[model samples]
Target: MLKFIALRLLQGMLVLLGIYAVTFVLVAATPGSPFSSERAIAPEILAQIEAFYGYDKPLGERFITSLGNVLQGEFGPSAVYANRTVTQIIAESFPVSIKLGSISLLLALVLGVPAGILAAVKRNTWLDYLPMSVSMAGICLPTFVMGPLLALVFGLILKMLPVAGWYGPEYVVLPATTLGLYYAAYFARLTRGGMLEMLNQDWVRTARAKGVPEHTIIWKHCLKGGLIPAITFLGPALAGIISGSFVVETIFQIPGLGQWFVRAALNRDDFLVLGLTVLFAAMIVIMNLLVDIVQVALNPRLKYD
Candidate 1:
């Protein structure tokens, strides 16, 4: 297990390095300097500013310097934000993203798993059809559309929730729900499919023949195996939730890393964009590693190579 973990970690590190290299190249290839938008500055003044930030250096030199700084845990100064570093911006905003992602994940599991189990158990009935229909609709509707609709009904019409702004606990509900429901639809379908397959397995028939209580068979024997697909989906899903919150955060006016990432891209804040990219890439790698570990734990028959 230790060897497996260490091997996975090494692979994850290599993946992160590849992501960083790709992102760095893209950012470098993008037209326009970080100071391109500045109004009517003297050429000498522009040159001085660029020199001060080491932007006057060649792209290769800058990349090497940035790589060295990152290795030492420094993300360098933000091009757009005065006196602020990329590290500082990430530190301030990541907690909000984490909070939103965590809640969304929990909501997806809580709502989706049960709905799926019920649908599978009650297959060919209204109980199955209704949830399946809803899940289909959810899969069709993108978060951009769904978010405003939710805000409109719950926040505007019912006055049950705020339309925007992430101030307190209540503010979390709308955004989290919007994000969660989208993934929940996918989860529900995956779960139902997994459960149905597990239910048809020979072991399940044997359990039934041995007179195991239906509920115990379903909950204990089937659920463990049924959940494998959902568990596997969680790794990439979690990464998506964290990085994809840009839309949700924007719609709801939440101050999270996703929002920062959006601004950094628009503003051409090279370091900030690269930092966020690396952070998100690292998160995805870590989550995937955890998923592999969990998969092994849940299925002793599986062995790590």
Candidate 2:
């Protein structure tokens, strides 16, 4: 187990390094200078600014320096934001994203698992058709479209929730629901399919023949194996949510890492963009590793090498 964990960690580090290098090169190659603007500054002043930020250094030297600083846990200063470090910005913004994502994920599991299970158990009945239909509608509606419709219904028409801003607990409900519902559709489908397959397996027949309670057979014998697909989807889904959903953040006017990442790209704030990219890459890698560990734990038949 120790060896498996170490191997996964090593692979994750390599993947993160590759992501950093790709993001660095792409951002470096992009056209606009971080200092460029609609208004012109004096050449000497611009030169002074460039020198201060080490933009005057050779490209290779800058990349090497940035990589070294990253290894030492220094993301350096934000070029556009006066007197702010990349680390500081991420620190301030990420908690909100985490809160939003956690609630959204909880909502997905709560709604999705039961719906999927019901659909699987009742195959051809109304119980099956109703939830599956809703799940299908969810899968069809993208978040961009869904966010506005939800905002219009709940926030504008019904006036039950705030349409924008992240002020209090109520502020999160719409955005979290919007994000959660979208993924819940996918989870519902995956779970239903997995449960159907598990229910048809020989063990299920054996349990039924031995007079095991139907609910116990379904919950204990089937659900454990059936949930594997949903668990697999969860790793990256959680990472993406926790990193911040850019569209949802923008639509709701939430101040999170997603908003900052968009601003950094548009304004050509290379350090901030690079920092966010690396952070997201790290999250994805770590979450996937955790998911793999959980999968192995749940299924002893699976071996780690």
Candidate 3:
């Protein structure tokens, strides 16, 4: 098990390194810098800007310097953010993103699990229809579209929730729902499938024959078996949310990591972009690794080591 975990960890590291390389290359290939979008500058001012950012250096040299900086936990500063370092940008933005993602994850689990269980238990009835229909609707609506629609209905028409701004729990409701519903659909589908399969297994049949209570058989035996695959999906799902809800946060103007991430990528803020990219990629990779370990531990009969 340790060997398996070690191997997976190495693989995860390599994958994140590749993701970092791709993002860096794309950022380097962009036509202009964030400074290019600014007003015309005198030669001395240009020199100052270039020198401050090491933009005047050769590309190879800059890349090497940037790599060294990354090793030292220096993500560099944002030219657009008035001398704020990428680390500082993330420091402020991460909390909001984390809060949003955590809320969304809770919502996804709360909605998805019960819906999926009911859908499976009452397979031929309206309960099944309801969850499937909801899942379809959720998958059909991207967060970009859903975020605004929610704002319109819940915020504008009803005026129950705030239309914009990240104030507190109420402020989180729409964005969390908008981000979570799609993932809920995904989890629901996965859970339904896993449950259907587990329900048919020989062990489940034996449990029923031995007069085990239906609830115990379903909850204790079937649920754990059903959860293994869902657990895998849940890990990455969580990582994605943790990185930030770009559309939901943006639509609501939450001023989270997603806001800076989008702006940095669009504005060609190299250091900021690279930093955010690496942060996101690293999170995803780490989550996946944790999923692998958990999957192995839960199914002890399976042997990878």
Tens-digit lDDT track of model 1 for 6-96: 9989998898888888999998899997888758888999899899888889988988998999999998999989799999999999999
* Tens digits of lDDT, candidate 2, 171-289: 99999999999888878888999899999999899999999999999889999889999999999889877765888999999998889999999989999999999999898888898
lDDT of each: 0.92, 0.91, 0.84
Q: Among these predicted structures, which one has the highest lDDT?
A: 1
Candidate 1 or 3, higher lDDT?
1
Q: Give the range where candidate 3 is weakest over 10 consecutive residues by summed lDDT.
A: 32-41
| Reference-based TM-score, model 1 | 0.97
Candidate 2 ranges beyond 4 A from true positions: none
Candidate RMSDs in Å, in order, are: 1.1, 1.2, 1.9
Task: Return whichever of 2 and 3 wins on TM-score.
Answer: 2
Error of 3 at 1 (Å): 4.5
The residue-by-residue lDDT of candidate 3 on 1-305, one tens digit each, is 67877897888778867877788778878887778755687879878888989988887798888888887888888867766899999999998898899889988988887788778777879989989889988978888898899889999999999988987879988989998887898888888878878888999889998999988988988887787767889778997776648878788889899888888877878889999988888888778778877877777776676
Candidate 1 positional error at 16, Å: 0.8
Please give the range of 10 consecutive residues that has the lowest summed lDDT in model 2: 237-246
